[model samples]
Target: MSSSLIFTFIFTLCLLSSCFSSSASLHNATDENVTLRPQHEIQKLKLIREHLQKINKPTVKTIQDPKHGHWWLQFGSGTLVGYWPVSLFTHLMEHGNMVQFGGEIVNTKPGGSHTSTQMGSGHFAGEGFGKASYFRNLEMVDWDNTLIPTANLRVLADHPNCYDIRGGVNRVWGNYFYYGGPGKNSKCP
Candidate 1:
């Protein structure tokens, strides 16, 4: 790991303890609609968006549902740094939004598309970018993290405790792991 990677792990490690204090499934807890509650995390989401935009300059979508009371911001439809794609970060953003908005993230596969959101299906399935359903992290589904030259650099920007929930076991697994999502599998140790 590089110095930056190590430093990032340390930063997110501080958030892990509080991120998973409760489990709020990305899918509905009981009904198909996962309840949405007011979140004090707009600042949190903004920080994430700012970091991605400043570093990669990918297109970002921001939405707030006061009726439902949540903020869903997603990034995708482009590449960042040629190797690392914004799609990878999109998944993590989805989870982070959930946690910030007071809900659990559904443990979708590392490369699976983001779907099964609180409002029935993810944003990707509805209209297009910014739909906010489980927003599809990638415009190109076939592309994998391997396409990125160094997973450590883009994915690990400032998050080290990240994990890929779909990886099955605990520990840093998969390139998605570097994204630092707020899922049980993605928590920092």
Candidate 2:
């Protein structure tokens, strides 16, 4: 419903996906019968238990709605994490008035000085392609729930010196944008 809630959901989903993938990669056994050392196995089990404990359990509950559909989030491994009824969002009942796709950063340091943290690719958007961070084949779901290309899209970057955004459309990428930069540079500071 609220933007902050939606952001939190997305942030949690990203964290879960990364954590699951990283933990799964710990299994190096090539064969089903491969056995690890006793100590190694214990350590692995402990690590997995800790990881599981750190994960936030989905707070969603099944709410049957014959009229409106539900929204779902899934992991990259094709695991269904959770689902919530669309009715929970008052603004999204009929259609969404606005949509946004971008990245953000937090200055962890206490002082006023900005931290030297990279936003996306650690390169300005003007660098393009392999050098800069980008989003491609952008599309939006209309009121009819049909996917359509974004139109009249406006790009905005808060701290242009620290991070910038550039939007474009091309035959290959369709509606795409290049963004992000190295933070805490001379110009940025």
Candidate 3:
């Protein structure tokens, strides 16, 4: 056979052999005994629904901003907190969302200043109040180049009191908070 034809044949054989080896390995590693538990799945679904309901359906209306995608839960005369990306805020406003009761997002700075610093949570430790354990900012563009928003929820396994939830445009700039346990504020460390 010509050198070029021989080389092509060898390459094709190598590719087919690799594919078969991968398939065989995958098949061999399959766990036939593993079964999904329906009860556990249902319980998880129920928990999620409960969480959603707490934050969404309230006796009052949720606040929304027309210019920027910031949402807030209003009470009495002041705004409790504002969420970026807007969708997560809307989700919290839905009936039967449990996340609504988790916490509120207080915009430390009114009128949405790009560089203004805001304080949240009644208690303060120096200047790091309301600082996110995982992220630094709320705009999705800051975390990623894309304008899309994402949400992250982390629950500490060892410490039942430690929990954090953040959602917004940038992973770096989002609303996040942690509470419960000894030295819970230092959990990010």
Q: Model 3 — which ten-residue stretch has the worst lDDT?
A: 4-13
**For each candidate, what TM-score against the reference?**
0.19, 0.61, 0.17
User: How would you encode candidate 1's per-residue C-alpha lDDT over 1-189 as one tens digit per residue?
Assistant: 111110010122124225422342122223567543324455334433343333331233333223342333434443221222334343432223211111134545565634322221112122421222121121111122122122221211232233221111122222221122332232332
Backbone atom clashes (below 3 Å) for every candidate: 9, 0, 29
- Shift in Å, residue 150, candidate 3: 28
lDDT ranking, high to low: 2, 3, 1
RMSD of each: 18.7, 9.6, 25.2
Worst 10 residues of 2 by lDDT: 57-66
Best by TM-score: 2
Count clashing pairs, candidate 2: 0
- The sequence of per-residue lDDT tens digits that candidate 3 reaches over residues 67-157 is 5544444432354644435554443232222222132233333444321221122232222322222222221222112332325544333
Model 2 alpha-carbon miss at residue 115, Å: 2.3
Clashing pairs in 2: none
Which candidate, 1 or 3, has the higher lDDT?
3
For model 1, name the residue pairs that clash.
Answer: 9-160, 24-104, 122-133, 122-134, 123-132, 123-133, 123-134, 162-180, 163-186
Model 2: how far residue 54 lies from native, Å:
33
- Model 3 lDDT at residue 32: 54
If both were scored by TM-score, which would come out higher, candidate 1 or candidate 3? 1
Candidate 2 — which residues are off by over 4 angstroms? 1-68, 74-81
Whole-model Cα lDDT per candidate?
Answer: 0.27, 0.61, 0.30
